[model samples]
Target: MERERVNRKIAAIFAADVAGYSRLMGMDEEGTLARLKAHRRELVDPKIVEYYGRIVKTTGDGMLVEFPSVVDAVRCAVEVQRGMVERNAEVPQGTRIEFRVGITVGDIIIEGGDIFGDRVNVAARLEQLAEPGGICVSGRVQEDTQGRLEIAFEDAGERQLKNIARPVRVYRVRPSAAAATARPALTLPEKPSAAVLPFQNMSGDPEQEYFADGMVEEIITALSRFKSLFVIARNSSFTYKGKAVDIKQVGRELGVRYVLEGSVRKAANRVRITGQLIDATTGAHLWADRFDGALEDIFDLQDRVATSVVGAIAPKLEQAEIERSERKPIGNLDAYDCYLRGMASLYQWSKESNDEALRLLYRSIELDPAFVSAYGAAAWCYVWRKTQGWVANSAQDKIEAIRLARRAVELGKDDAAALSAGGITFAHIAGDLDGGAAFIERALVLNPNLAGAWLNSGWVRVWLGEPEVAIEHLARAMRLSPLDPILFRMQGAMASAHLFAGHYDEASAWAEKALRENPNLQQGLRVAAASHALAGRLEEAQKAVARIRQLDPDFRISNMQDRLPAVLRPQDFARYAEGLRKAGLPG
Candidate 1:
């Protein structure tokens, strides 16, 4: 038998590499080579020596170093990145060099000055995962350097490093230059990006821990259905379940603009769920609320929490995105940029804006044919045309609207916006009420947090002759998004629901609310006129009728049958026509 000898020593390994080094070198080999050498000589070499790290080896685009202390390794990485930022200021944007660094602490086999084994590989893998001009470190390195350094570390969750045997917990080092340069700002997705952190289980009962985790996962799933949102996956967010985290750090680590954090307290048959939305860049609390409900309704609470967070953040996100687009230099906007501009136009709800919205959405689809959101929104523009009586050619426009709607549904079967918008278009423009309602129901199943789906469900119920159910669904929509941009739409739905149920005063009240938000909204005026007439407020009813006539002068009670396929439900047409006739509409 031969004696086996193994040499091992715990060491902190640091790996640094230039992001897109191959591309840079390919673009200008001579210039890139000269710059790399100069960087190592002027900035890199001095920092390594000052931190007391030994140079193990150097590749053309990367290097490996051994540090005796994790703190020193992190400090050296930070200083180098800051120096790179300053150096990059003198270069063209296209030729900028950004280095990514990774650090890890583990037992390694040191043959001479060079190191080998899993420890070294892990460091390299971490480097590859790091963002350009950023640092990534293993959980051990973060733990050791926690109190020893002045820098902050953001939890990046568990990462499955390529070829590594075990998963490594990762954190991002917040460099001082993060504030000095826009390079460190989160690269926001074309749409809003958000993360729902694991809920804090304040119940003190370990058994209910599962409940809290489930709540966050449900929220993530619900948010995922929104075509307008880029939601962080559940696996990544749950990594911070038991950790004390900084919201801005989470935002940077996740590369999202908003963060939703909450706590769950369960005791016996009751539970309390509290949530708050934060703007990661400014550390501002965008929204906050709490829900108290029965334990059996825990699932509903989860859905509500998800809905509330999205509803609260969506308008803010949209306004911010719109402002961003408005400020962008002209002629280089991509598909998403056009889409955001279209959204801003559509929300204005004027005839000129409606045309502009349609044009921009069409341009967006032309830019990226696979953009599901643009198609859905484009189809929705036609729905607006029909509702507002702005159609230049009903026959031709209907054909085009149907084509766009069908395409949206096919491309975005899993997206709540597509499903809901396509369904409503089919229901309103194509008069396939049943088929459209089925799609809306599927959208709700895909994402119960979708406030629009709930509101649409209410309208679908009314069209199907289920007025009470319509009211109930609308109430749910309101609770989920008390501050939604579509609140006026929900109010109009509620008004229609009450009107069909013969609750004249209630209908009038809701219609009034809708009109207050959107005085020109056709549905609001129709419902208000009908409800006031049915309640014997003849003067008010006549005033509403006059206002509606200004928007749709050809309006007549008899035309309701052709205009509203929803009137097919039993006596629904008669009910609507009777009220309209009494309100002074032509019969």
Candidate 2:
């Protein structure tokens, strides 16, 4: 049998489809078809032509395109994505149409007005890998377009593509222009930016509207003081005060990374304030918290609520940026990126991650020698190691920690994050309780809304043997940042405060809550065991002790005080040791 010679040619194959097309049609068939047609006619088809792409064919929800070069294909895809973003800005999210695009450079079999080949199959598979409103490309395409385009590529790593003979390394394109177009009305500042929209009045009295507006204005003013943040002015933010507006549109108009929208309710002599922080670019809710206080001092309550909201979302914004930095390719790491990545590693709370965090923080410092937050964060890493009983060379670690903390404090006299981090490190690692407390108090004065400062103050008070004050500080931190990633740590500190206050049952309950969040938290486990034992829950205490043994086999009651903060008073340490002994900890 003789095989007919197949006509073939090398080309850049482009594949695209509307994500969730069937669902959109199911929801609104006529409207979906009309919008899809309008998009193709106005945006997609024009972009394809402008980029010198030949549209091979079109299905109801997708189309196949061929280009002379990979550059043309990628450029066209990015334009389409950007155009879709702009067009859908006004459209409701549920009904918005987003496209997934993929491109590859390979040989293709050509027929009369049609095409078929493995390259075509690869392009379709790559499209499936792309996120909605995103583009993915084969490694070959990425190599060809290197330095030829202004787009950034995130290495998605090798993926075992469906039904493909071999694995394909995919790269997700992150177009810088897409971000620019996302906020066409304004350019975002380099620093983390946010806007505080006027809180809605849910108190059923129009008179309460002033209270909500006043709360937002105070928040805006307090947030403006953070040197690290770029806050939208009150005048600009209040433009949407009385109107129903989309968060994404607000983000675009204001050119900010985060949007805070909340509500206020007043009843009798008591008032409640609820706030939520959202990532403007992606519309993801990052943090939310509520504050309740008496209306005896309305202005004072407003000030407290404002400070609380800022305290909560600042870390969340940083966390969101860290996650964003992680998504970028390793080659794209700047000084801030390195710092963010280091913070991410630090939060993992493992020995290995802690080491990596230190290395990355040092790298960040090497890149920017005067980065105060990096120095402060690095100092805290050593403090974390001391708490975990992971310090191998105590003298060397203490010297390095002190050096870093002092540098942070000296350089960042007005930086709250740096001051708080450095101050806590001093208290925990150097036993400079008074010095650390002074620095943290200064941080609070500088940025009263900083949650980290409040948290650090809580621990400082614990070491100072002010258990009641510690509880209050920790409670403030919790209410300010309820969704904080380190919430378990806060809860554990609360348990310790309760334990030292002779509230054994409260200590046990708080420790159990911390354990629920992180079963392997050694501090939480120890607190749980001690509190349960002291509260006469012998069975629960035994269970916690067993888990503590599992986590750290060398745990002993005699050496337990060494694992605790250095500044704990003799009486508090005695109480903790007695509870551990009752819990049957090793002698």
Candidate 3:
């Protein structure tokens, strides 16, 4: 007898088992084993090695492997599936071998050259959950595998497993084409809906990819404010990043009826952004434009791109709105360059990013004090500090935020960003909800492409107890800024509005969808909890409450007034409060 001791480490475990293996073996035992051996030797093993994965054990019909990295595990899984696909092409569909693979990353006990732990068990269970010729992965694997692989994952939610101590979050992974084809085509809701696809970096310079992506994001942010758009989050849209995709396929995968696609090319001293809008169902080009400008005038270029995109989708969008979308700094374009850098920093949403963004934004305003957008960006830094609890004096930050926001509006009343920021600051910090809503609405009318304006307007309406109207505006915002990072805020607003209207099911569904994009979205958790409670789902409501506390331990309705827009109508306030209470929110 020999004894061995080794420390346990967290690793991605990949478990796979052949589907219908018993039937195949029963049909021809020797042939089945021989074919399986040959496949492993010739195709599967090499790909696994190529992806830097190690095989731990092999059952006659299944294999268990350990990957040093999650990226490798995912890549190996995708390649194995792809290779299997090619190998199966020659055989009759019914006679071809298929595999169901499951991946999980967690701590596992290693003993006697065999792996053992709950993690292993979870992977095995997930493998069982996978469809034939498909891959299933634990939530841990999903989080770790993003940005490192070219795979698409559909949420399977929590699943109950036999003998498993707890339910597991699972994601189903399949070939992108197969997944798109598998989705049932559904009619668009009467509501406004849209999808944002990754903008192609036609600049030829790889460094400019981030710039092009950032511009798309800004456009999405502007549209998200409209409150009438069903904007897909950036993460969802960016999944198609660097992939050749069809507009119809994008719509089907994202469940949006309209699609926005474009390319960005930047030369030494000139830049051009070309965009097109298409009806996803018909694949008909609804609108197209090419924006060319000096590199120094990048801000103006972005504004033009946004205006053209908005004008194409909603012909009724007024010229005033287009002008608002085109608003930029009145002084040096250098300041605008700094502003873009500031925006890039802000997108990171970290302490370091915040500091860098604040510094750059201040520099932009210093160079061009008349720059209303810079003021708005500065106000946002205060908002971020306050929200993140990084402010030394919350009251002071609120006052400064309100002042800067108001200044932005005064300086650029025609600018959508200025109006949007001013309205949000007034509603959330100044406690002047009606005034804020009015400003946001004015901004929206001036630029239907202003997603932020629509989103803010929708928030105001929801606070005023007009949920149906809010939903429309939010949907429009979504359409304009389908790839915005903060678009989840609009989704949460929609859910909140639905909850207040006593549309519990719709509220829950939207909230779930929002959380799907951002699991830690506080507003989504609140709305989801309230919706579940209103629908008599006490367990679910409690679970949502638990999640809320996990994210914001000190959260309560009493403090919500300071945190939320104050423009809500009495009825709306009461309804929202009631839902929160029912959802187990503390008074």
- Give the best candidate by TM-score: 3
The best-first sequence of candidates by TM-score reads 3, 2, 1
The lDDT for every candidate, in the order shown, is 0.81, 0.81, 0.77
* Candidate 2, superposed: residue stretches over 4 Å from native: 1-333
Steric clash pairs (candidate 1): none
lDDT of 1 by residue, 1-587 (tens): 99878788888999999999999989999999999998898889888998999999999889999999888899889878877876787598879889999999989997776799998999999999899999999999999988666567889999888999889999998843434443343334557778888889999987667567756755776666665776765545665678898887777666688999999998878999999999986699999999999866665676677667777768655543322212111122367567767876887788899999999999989988888878988998988877777878888988998899899899888777689989988888888998889889989877665667788789889988899999999987764444445578889999999998989999999999999989998888988988998899989999999998897888887666435543356577677667778999987
Q: Per-residue lDDT of 1-587 in model 3, one digit per residue for the tens? A: 68766669878899998999999888878877887888788778887887778788998788899888888888788767766775676577666788889999999888767898898889999999988888999888889876566567899999987788899999997556555454433334445567667789998888777678866876665554444455665556776888888788677556677788898888889888888889996699988888888877776777776666666666676666556555444558677678878987887766679889989988988898888888987887776665444566777877888888889889867776788878877776677887888888778765565667778788777777678898998887775555556766778888888888789999999999888877877678878987898799988988998998887787788876554554656676677677779888898
Instruction: Give the candidate number with the greatest lDDT.
Output: 2
**1 versus 2: better TM-score goes to:** 2
True-structure lDDT of candidate 1: 0.81
lDDT of 3 at 127: 94
**Superposed Cα deviation of residue 197, candidate 1 (Å):** 16
TM-score of each: 0.47, 0.48, 0.55
- If candidate 3 were superposed on the true structure by all CA atoms, what would the RMSD be? 17.9
Could you tell me which 10 consecutive residues in candidate 1 have the lowest summed lDDT?
322-331
Task: Estimate the overall C-alpha local distance difference test score of candidate 2.
Answer: 0.81
